[model samples]
Target: MNSASDAVKEIVIEIVNSTPFWTAFSACFIAYLNRNKGKKLTAEKDGVKFSLENMNHHEMTEALEDAKKIMVSDNGKKPT
Candidate 1:
């Protein structure tokens, strides 16, 4: 019984240490972490909430330009 248990333990350890298992596990873990890292920026104005990530490139550029104009109009205060 002792020898049988030891063999089983070794087999389990070997399986856990295998390259394929590690590769699959790493891929899944990285995907999970990236999924959570992709949280969109949110803003609330006039009691309306919206996500910045939903904007297209043109819209993003326009918004950034508007922000720069605002900053420039505020006595040439450079953004930190």
Candidate 2:
């Protein structure tokens, strides 16, 4: 590669690898990717299903209970 391109590549690698000043680009990039996922809550039964990305306390509780019931009924058997 050309010197200029090689220098740019080296700088990017250093930015991603350095952590002393918490200036690592990779750290921020990973955090940004995780931040986009948010929280996911889901419940499914036979042919029915429910999902929540953002939910209230009441909804969270209800969804969790539904999930528990479905899990209990599975009785150690795994889905195909």
Candidate 3:
């Protein structure tokens, strides 16, 4: 069990070591988006619920940038 744990750790180490920053970032972002789905920016405004699907492409892109900015600022760390 200890050796298995060590092996797993080694594999993780290799993966993290070999992965480029952008690739890791993209993977994490995709996973986050997948997990979030309908939860992303869903809000009740007035009597209407707003979501990313309601936004235009430019607005959606800006919203994503805003979300990334908030995340990085709050955590003091870049995604992935």
Candidate 4:
């Protein structure tokens, strides 16, 4: 019983000491999973939402042009 309790205490101590490393590893793994290159983007306005992932070539080009026009017209200020 005494040796068994000592082994459990050692295991607990090891886990506590390794917490920070495991936490960092988990964070890096999650960040790698969420890396944004080539990720789908969604736009929302007036409660309407659409995903660019579903758009094809023509639609995507048109959306890009519309976005450019809006930016130019707004002079780059946030719209209220």
lDDT of 1 by residue, 9-54 (tens): 9998786656555455445434443454544344343444445444
Q: Model 3: runs farther than 4 Å from truth?
A: 20-22, 26-80
Model 2, 16-60: lDDT tens digits are: 344432233224333433465643334464445655445444444
List residue ranges in candidate 2 displaced over 4 A: 1-41, 45-47, 66-68, 71-80
Candidate 1's displacement at residue 3, Å, is 4.5
lDDT of 3 by residue, 1-80 (tens): 57988999998766644435335444554455456554343433344444543455444443443222222212233433
- Top TM-score model: 1
Error in Å for residue 32 of model 3: 6.8
Name the weakest run of 10 consecutive residues (lDDT summed) in model 3.
Answer: 66-75
Give the range of the ten consecutive residues with the poorest summed lDDT in model 2: 71-80
Q: Quote each prediction's TM-score.
A: 0.37, 0.28, 0.30, 0.26
lDDT of each: 0.45, 0.43, 0.45, 0.45
Displacement of residue 59 (Cα, Å) in model 4 is 0.8
Task: Kindly report which residue stretches of model 4 are placed more than 4 angstroms away from their true locations once superposed.
Answer: 1-39, 44-49, 68-80
Q: Candidate 1, clashing residue pairs?
A: none
